[model samples]
Target: MPAAATVNSPRHAMSDTLNQPTSFSAIDFLRTKSLANVVQAEIERMIIDGEFQPNERVNENALSQRLGVSRGPIREACSALAAMGLIEIIPNRGFFIRALSSDESQDLSEARAGIFGCMAMMLAERVTVAQIAILRALLARMDEIVALGEVHTYYPVNLEFHKQIASMAGNNRLGSIYQSFVRELHIQRYRALSSPDVLHISNAEHREIVDAVEARDPVRALIAGRAHILNGIVRAKKAQQAGEATAQAKAAPRRTRRTAAAMEETAAGTPADAATKPRARRGGLSKTD
Candidate 1:
C-alpha cells in the first residue's frame, strides 16, 4: 500500500487501540468521590455522635441500606475516615471505630486549640455586630442550661457555638480542619463537659472570647480561644481521673468481697480432695472392722 493510503486507513491498529474505552475515567472518579463524600459525612456524624460506639465494627451493609447507596461508596467513605483517624481498617476483620489514645487525644486537642485560636483572631478583626449578638445569645442560653445543670443539653449547644465561630471566621480550609478536630475530640469533649462546674467554666470562656472579639482585641481573643480548649484539657483530665477513681472505688468492694470469700474458704479448713479421700484410722490404716 502507498504511504498516503496507509496514513488514511480506517482500520489502523493505532486507531483501534485509541478507540477502546477506558475502564475508568475522570467522570467516574468524580462521581465516586461525590458519593463517597456523602457517605463519609453521614458515617462521620454517626461515629462522632456516638451512634456508633468506639471499637465497634462499621456495618457497611447497614450503612449502604440506610444511605441508599452501594457498599463501594460506604467502603470508600470508611477508608477516608480511617485516614482521618475516625476509623481503623484491619485486614480480613474490616473497619472499626477508632479510640484515640491519651497522647493522640492530647495532640488533637492542642492542634485544635491552635486552629480555634486562629479563628478567634480572624473573627476579632472582621466580626460583625450580628455575629457578636448570636454568640451572646448562645452564651445566654448556655447559662440557663448551666443553671439547670443539664450537661447533656449543654454539650450540643456548646458544639453549635464553636461551629458558629468557625463559620463566621470565613476561612473554609480553617473551618474544615477545626471541624475535623472537633469530630475526633467528641468523646473527650463530652466527658470533659459532663460536669456542672466544667459547663460553667466553658461558658465563661465563651464569654471571654466574645468579649475580646466584641472589643476588636485579637490578642485577647486568641488567648481566650486557646485558653478555652487548653482549660478543657485540664477539665478533661480531672474528669478522667475522677472516673477512674469511681471505677476503682466500685471495684474495690468486689475485690474485698472476693478476698473475704477466699478467707472464709481458708477458715473452713476442708480441702475438696480431703473430703473425697477416706480418713486413716489409728494414723496408719483404713481400719476395716
Candidate 2:
C-alpha cells in the first residue's frame, strides 16, 4: 500500500497535529491513542458530512451525551481537531467548525497547488505501471459519474483520484500536508464544484495530469497539477461572490404591499387633507397586505 494517510486514519492525522504547536499537549497526544481518538474521528466525520456545519459551535455536552462519554474526552477530541485545522478553539468560548474566509481559502489553495504540483512532478518521473492503472481506473469511474452528472457522487471519487496521486508520489511529508489541506478544503470544495459542469471541467484537467505523468513529462505534470488547484481557487471566488450576492439580496427586505401603496400615493400626489385623514393603526405589514 502507498504511504498515504488512509481515508480517515487518525494516526497520520495525529502525527501531523503532534508536529504542530496548537497547544496540543503530550497528555492530549496519549489521549488520542485512547478513547479521545474515537471521539475525534466521529467529530471529523460529522464535519466532513456537514452534520456539523462551518462556524457552528460544537455542543460539548450534547456530544458527551451522544458519544456516551464525559465532557473531558469531548474537549480533548476537539482540541485535537483544532490542531487538524478542522475546528477553531476560542478562548473562553468553545469549539466551532472552522470557516475559511475567501482570502484564507485562496491562500490555502495556492499552498496546496505548489505542493501538489511538486508531487505531480515526482510522480511523473517514478510512478510504476500499477499506480498508473489505479489512476486510469479512477478516471474511468469519474467519467462514468460525470456522464450521469451526479456531483455528489463524483466529488468523493475526484478526491480519491487526487489522493491516489499524492500517495503515489512517494513522499510522506508532502502527502501529509496534502491531506491536511484536503481536510481544510472540504467545505469550500463543495462550493467550488457546485455543478456538474464544474466536475466535468475538473476531470478534464485530471486527464492532463495523468497523461503528463504517463509520458514522464515532469514539467507538464507540474503545470497540470498547479493549474487544477489555481483554477479551483477561481471557482471558489465565484462561489463566494454568488453566496454574498444571495445573502445581500436576502438582507435587503422586499418592499411590503403597504410601502408600495404609500409610494404610489405620494407619486400621484396625496390629497391636501390626507394628513387630516385618520392614519391606519400601526401593524406589521405582510408582503401581500
Candidate 3:
C-alpha cells in the first residue's frame, strides 16, 4: 500500500509552519485593543453628544444591533464605561447613563482645578519657546473664532489649548488623569462656556495662564489655572440657575391656568365670571341699606 502513504504529505505541512516563530503586525496591535474598547469609545461619544441623556437606560440590544456587534461585547463595554464613571449599572434595572449630582459635580470641578493648577505650574517650569509659540498660535485661532462670534467652534480649540498645556507638563500620568476629569465634565463645561461672554472671559483666563507660563512663573501659572477652573465652576452654576429660573418663568402661567381650571371644576354649577369674583357675605346688609 505504498507504505500506507505517509501521513505527513506535502499538503499537510503543519509541522514546518508550527515550528516557525510568529510575527506581529499593525493589525495584531490593533486587535490587541479589544472590541470592548472600541464599543466603549463609541458609547462615550454617544453620551458626550447628548444622544443618551443622563439617567437614561442603555439598551443593550439596541446598541448591539446598532453597532453590529454581539450582546457580549455590549455588556463588556458597559462594564468598562461604568468603571470610567460614565455609566451606572443596576442589579435588575440594567445600565443607565450616570448623572453627576450638583455636589458631586462641584467636587469634581474642585479636584480638576487642583490637578490643572499643578499641570500649569509644571508647564511653566518646563515649557519651551516652541511650546509657547504653539499656544500663542492656538490663542490666535481662538481670537479669530471669537471675532466671528462663533462660540460653538471655540469649545474644541479651548480643549486643545488646555490639552497642549498638559502635554507640555511632561507627565503622562497627570495628563491621563486630567483627561478623565475633562471627559467627566465635558457636558457641564460646554454648558458653562456656551455664553459668548463666558467664552471671552475664559479666553482671557487662558491668556493669563499662557502669559504666566511664558514668563516661567510657576506660582503665577498655578494661581491662574486654579482661578480659571474655579471660575468655570461658578459660571456653570450660574448658567444652571438661570436656566432653571427661565424654565420656571415659562411654566408659571401654565401652572396658574391649571390651578384656575381645577378651582373652576371644584366650583361647578357657578357662572364662569363668578369664579374670579369674591363670594358675598351671607346675611350681610344690601347696598341699598
Model 1, 1-289: lDDT tens digits are 6987887787686786665666346556666768789789889777756588778998888888888999998999899988888888989999999888999999999999999999999999999999999999999999999999988799889999999999999999999999889878887888898688778889989999999999999999999999999999989889989988999999999999999987887787547536645544334463543
What candidate 3 gets wrong by more than 4 Å, as runs, is: 1-32, 269-289
- TM-scores for all predictions: 0.73, 0.73, 0.76
Q: Residue 113: error of model 2 in Å?
A: 0.3
lDDT of each: 0.88, 0.87, 0.87
Best model per TM-score = 3
Greater TM-score among 2 and 3 belongs to 3
Model 1: colliding residue pairs: none
Return the lDDT, model 2, position 234: 87
RMSD of candidate 1 to the true fold? Answer: 12.2
Model 2 is weakest, by summed lDDT over 10 consecutive residues, at: 279-288
Output the number of the lDDT-best candidate. 1
* Model 2 agreement with the true structure over 1-289: per-residue lDDT tens digits: 3555373478878777778765567667666678888888888877876688789999998898899999998999999989989899988899999999878888899999999999999999998899999999999999999899987788788889988999999999999999999989887877788767777898899999999999999999999999999998888778778888998877666646568877888887677446545343223233337
Candidate 3, 1-289: lDDT as tens digits: 5544555665446665555555345466567879888888889878876688788999988999999999998999899888888899999999999889998899899999999999999999988999999999999899888877676688889989989988999999999999999888877887787677777788899999999999999999999999999999989889888888999999999999999988887687456456445435322436436
Q: Which residue pairs in candidate 3 have backbone atoms (N, alpha carbon, C) closer than 3 angstroms, thus clashing? A: none
